[model samples]
Target: MGQHEKVATSLADAVGEEIGASLAPVDAELERLYPGDPGTRQPVHTVYVPGDAFAADTVRSWGDRALDALDAHAPDAASFAAVLGLADDLAEPVYARVRAKLEREPVEDLRVDFEDGYGPRPDDEEDQAAARAARLLAEASARGTAPPYSGIRMKCMEAPVRARGIRTLDVFLTGLLASGGLPDGLVLTLPKVTYAEQVTAMARLLEAFERTHGLRPGRLGFEIQIETSQAILAADGTATVARMIQAAEGRATGLHYGTFDYSACLGVSAAHQASDHPAADHAKAVMQVAAAGTGVRVCDGSTNVLPVGPAAQVHAAWRLHYGLTRRALARAYYQGWDMHPGHLPTRYAAVFAFYREGFAQASARLARYANRAGGDVMDEPATAKALSGYLLRGLDCGALDTGEVARLTGLTRADLESFAVPRRGDLTASSG
Candidate 1:
């Protein structure tokens, strides 16, 4: 028989219970408000087409134009590599994938712009355009010609355009629902949101739409366009962006940066008004932190330096776009906006190169971790999560194929998902 030793701990079980009871509501609130990332296929980039200019073959046309730009400027892998400083080994593979991706799936996400792109228009004219966008998008969906995710960006909910924006949104959604119901990839964007209350209004509007259409609750979610300084910081000096996410009440899907508008809001000169600017980084950092673990993704803003003019000018623009895209990816910002077709090649080039460059090493490390085979790099569960997520994103964007990733890591799609996205039960257990 073992003799009992004197207990050194002073606290009783009741004390622990008291603390737990006090913080029970905090636990519930955390679960309700901060749902983790929604494990979904996020697009690598979003391409915006003006409302009136969008057509049935818009996605295909954009791809063709991008391919043409590649053909005209960087006809060979060597030339493209020279322009982007891509290593020699990656040149052939990345180039091939970028070209094939352009031919196969060029535009991952397309937003039909009804706001700034369409400009002010007659009521009837705007109504017709909205209806036409719905019809064309529905037709494209049926024909398998549409991008993976497609939607409209209505005008902001500001006083000057509130009625117009609501009407346009109603027309579009109604038209879509009438034609074989909304597609699974349906998305919406509300631009230039300045106040948290504006976000609440959008949520309420969507809820009303759902009730009117006899759809389920919380069916429509949107990306809040973070362009105004007021949205970033309120007069009271709080992080209004965080408040905005709370205001969505589980309906906010993303926070999209607006490069030009945000830069102008801060009074930055046009020359320095780019996605990688210091001001831009500050804004996006706040956005990123605010959105973390809220299931709200963040999208970087676009660049205005279009790849036009002569060959030299096109090359310069391509380099800029490529560098920006790659930089954003490294910073954990997976998505950005592509305003012009010429930006497509470099966009894909940078993305493809990034994934391809680290493929071998990442695959090996992940394999070792999975097998519990120790290696030079000590891996943690969190590291495994990141590694799996990296591979999955590469797979989603067509940079790495399923067979290849599976062959390398010996993990199936489901296996990778298990590591990348933890279950709620698992999270709760770990938290305790």
Candidate 2:
């Protein structure tokens, strides 16, 4: 009964998914990855620290610094409390906990970026960076500091950087093997992938790495960045996300959108490189349709705005991040990139608010549909599944507790657990 009770606390119906983080394999950020309270708090934001600054000791302190910033610029938790309809005294404690979480684990997924974050470094410098990143990976593994989802991002395999990207990956993998082997849940990020051939090439490279390192053939899975126009629309004017996944030959784990780059490819001016631009919507819609049942997770990009002003002025940045995150959540893109510490509070606030606002209606409707007892309105299987997903997401993100989910959905813990293990096809099926 004790074991069951502990295990049942999980969002039993939540599916395995990936979130985005682009960090420079620097020391300050790394040490913080495994904070003091690993399970007490979870990070909603992904840190994007530059590669040049990545150091082992320094990486460890990034989380604490972010927490300090959160405390310093503690935005009026007014909006957060208002959305949940909490009183001032109660909300103050809740906000304090949120603030504590920001400091404890501000980074959920850390991407040791060698691409844009690293930029173009000298060959020897890039090689050294790869080596140091490998060392950090080893240390993180030993200390249990690696995030639940973590890895490195190499330069694009298109154009002039293809050879360099391959070399960087080779060096990094070699170093990782020598240090402590690949960590569990490590994903490689291939940025600006424009053709099926690039993905196929990466698959071949990963296979080679596995063989050379004495690992299994498919040990490494990679994510493709859908940044360019070609990645979205091929020369024949067809959707490419599914095709790229197919070319990955089962090595494709996720697809991430590069908001600014994609917009630039569409010829949108710098001023208009916004997340909600119609161009992004069209591309993401296509991505959702093409990769629906393939199990390839899709991640939205981060906002460029940083909260650098005084506490009074920081809420604007918070509001922007909150709005963007909310938009992504509404579209079912739960995971996204977080570029700054300010984004941490808003990320959780937006997610919790979204889940809390619709909880009662969604739970009632899902219960009625699941029981085959029609309620006030017609409920289709698809709607039921989406409703179930909403509740599951709430549970997964800690927005709703397992007990609350059970009460609202009338599902036992085991039933909730079963709801979380379905394949994409099963989850999205027209009939249950």
Per lDDT, the best of the predicted structures is 1
Model 2's alpha-carbon lDDT is 0.72
Who wins the TM-score comparison? 1
Put down candidate 1 lDDT per residue, 55-140, tens digits, no spaces.
88888898999999989999999999999999999999889998999999999999999999889999999999999999998988
TM-score of each: 0.95, 0.81
Predicted candidate 2 versus true structure: per-residue lDDT over 47-82, tens digit per residue: 555556666754456566555656566545765565
**Candidate 2: stretches off by over 4 Å:** 1-46, 57-62, 79-97, 369-374, 377-381, 410-414, 421-432
Per-model lDDT: 0.93, 0.72
RMSD of each: 2.8, 12.4
